[model samples]
Target: MSSRSNISQYQGLLERIVLCFLSTGPACFFLLINGILMFSLRSKPVFRYTCRYILLYNLLVADTAQLIVTQVLFLLAVGRVKITYAVCGTITTMANLTAGISPLTLVIMTLERYVAVCYPLRHASIVNIKNTVVAIIAAWAVSTLNNVTRNLFLIEYPYEKFGKVLMKDYCTNIGWIPDSLCDDYDRAYNAVVFVSASITVISSYTGVVIAAKAASTDKASALKARKTLLLHLVQLFLSLAYTLYYPLLSALAKTVQRIVFVWVQNVIYVLFIVLPRCLTSLIYGLRDQTVRPVLLHYLFCRWKLSVEPATC
Candidate 1:
């Protein structure tokens, strides 16, 4: 009996170590890729001056931060490392706050594309450097407001009763949910953001298609703009998956065996967390003609650079 118990413990520990590697491996890769893309964005004058590239840079910054926070939470959960309610709350709040920025940035990017396609004559004046800066600031400001609202709701919890208390479960955005009121607030906020953003992107896509058919608006450019808008919608779906993956895995845990739950969680984590976080890098890093050569130059440690800038 003693020998059997020892073997079981060893197997479980080994399994956890492998799981951590499986999950963190891709996250680290994406981190490296995003870092390169960020550097590439700052490497050229055009990237710095263009409205859309500036927004892509903004989006990458938020996604990278969120990815780091997420990896920390994953490590804590897998290693069974205990954390206090205060620590958990702070970390989870940061995660939630950063997650909100992606969709907002996407909405802004979609609108920018709409303007460039439908109203090319005024695109320059309408989406200038000053306006782009303000849009990015407004995105962060809104996310911060949402963060503030979450903290306010959290203050009502009776943390004083249990001073310096460690949370029972692993630290997560959903770990120590304070009250139903906060949950309701979160749901409503998410719903409004998601719906409003989706409608904006989809509507803009429709308008761009109509404009392409009616006017002589650079057929190739219009086609690419429509494709980019569609990619934005896909990105929205991936971002929403990040928000809901934890609750979903938790609910599934109740129905499955422990071994099954662990495997499913790992798979879903890589898909939801790893895949989406790096998506921005892949989209603009490789897709944009102007960015590709520069991004590749950075990715290869600036060893070679010969390609001319092309249309994004």
Candidate 2:
């Protein structure tokens, strides 16, 4: 029994160490990459005005907020720290607000791509910088309102037998709210958003593909259109994976051992949330033809300066 107990304790410690790295490492890297992208876009007027870069910038901001919240929760869990009801509630609300905004933003991005690809002649008027900025603000406002309303029902001060606020692994809706309500809300929210967004993305991408195929007279333009829509589909799929992550994590928690549950949860969080957010910088920002050249040029200049001998 003693040996088994020691083994279990060590295993838990190992899990915590791994979870800390998984949570913080990607977040820091994402912040760095996003900073570079933001600076590059802001410094270049051409990229700043482009609808695609504007949408991507908003997405990066949303993802960074989500990552910061997630990392804080991970730190609390690893340290076994209990927080006040208000603090926990505030963190949970912020996390939900950011989480809600991410998918909505992605949906808007897909719609923007649809307009740009399917209605090339009107794309400028329809998806300009001004319209993109307004859409981003609307997405943030709607998501914030929805999450704030839902969080109002959260039970922030749930207590144990000794009349102390119960500590939890993370500040989450499921941890703070009644199980039934949490289940119902999650199901309703996921069903409505996931189904609606999936339909919009699929339909829009289909239109884009069809439009690209029909415009075979400009073969290069048609090919570029198809490729751009394909990237959008990839991004949509990643966002869908993130949407489904919570329900899957809940299911696993009920069935798995304590150690197994923590391990799986951390892995799921990193893979579905962190990894996809990092990939967005690569797929949507850096690899973009217009942005790539600017990024490369900036990096090359910085590199050249570091290597050149100092002037006498």
Candidate 3:
């Protein structure tokens, strides 16, 4: 029994070290790629001005914010350190705010693509720079309202009798809600938003598919429509995974042994939460035609000669 216990402790320590590496590696890479993308966007006026690029930029910003907060939380978790209620609450709030923005921005991107693909003639007038800015602002505002309101119900600051000292080994939403009622409330709120967003995304992508089919005579337009729709679908799938994976893992954590739960949660956090955010910039933003050339030019050809702007 003593030998087994010693081995178990060593295994746990190894797992944590691996988890820390997984968490930080992707985070640094995400920051690097997103930073370069942002710089490329700013330096090239033509790519920066388009509605799609603008929305992509906003998505990148939200993902980066969420990634940073998540890394902080991950480090704290790995250290097994207790944090003050106030500090934990602030971190939770920022994380929730940024996480909320991602789905909202994704929905906006879906709608923008729907318009561009489904109504090619009116895409120019419908999704101009001014309206795109408004849409991005509205996405942030709506996400903020949703997160703030939901968090209010989920957490009670004065958790103890003295109303001052609240400390926990882990800083997470699970700590904030003291009972099942708050849990139910959080679930209900998320359900409504998730369902609504799902409906909108499905409807928009369905329209895009139909439009693409109708434009089969124009090979170039149809191909572009299909490619864009496929990318949107992948993003939507990742968003769904990011949103749902945590709740499921949290529920499972309650039923498992402490050692098992820790390992499971760490794996799920890195795989579902961190990996998707890092991939968003690569899969969605960098692969984009307008942005890709700028990235390539900066990394490869910037010193040699001037690169002509690509048509939107």
Q: Quick one: best TM-score, which candidate?
A: 1
Off by over 4 Å in 1: 159-163, 304-312
Off by over 4 Å in 2: 1-15, 155-169, 215-217, 297-312
- Model 2: weakest 10-residue lDDT segment is 303-312
Candidate 1 lDDT (Cα, 0 to 1): 0.88
Tell me how candidate 3 scores on lDDT: 0.74
Rank the candidate models, highest lDDT first. Answer: 1, 3, 2
lDDT of 3 by residue, 1-312 (tens): 999999998987887888788778877877888777777767766767778878888888888888899889888888777777777878877887887777778777878877777777888899898998998899888878866676666445455632356565588767754567666766776677677777877787677667656734355665675676566666766765666665767798789987787778777887778877877768755666666776766666474434456433
Candidate 2: lDDT over CA atoms? Answer: 0.71
- Top candidate on lDDT is 1
Which tens-of-lDDT digit does each residue in 1-312 have in candidate 1?
999999999999999999999999999999999999998887767787888989999999999999999999998998989898878888887888789899999999999999999999888899988999999999999999998887787676786843498888898766667577877898899999999999999999999999999757889989999999999999998877786787788798899999989888989899998899899999888998878888888888876665443222
Q: How many backbone clashes does candidate 3 have?
A: 0
Selected candidate, larger lDDT, 1 vs 3: 1
TM-score of model 1 vs. true structure: 0.94
Evaluated at residue 197, the lDDT of candidate 2 is: 78
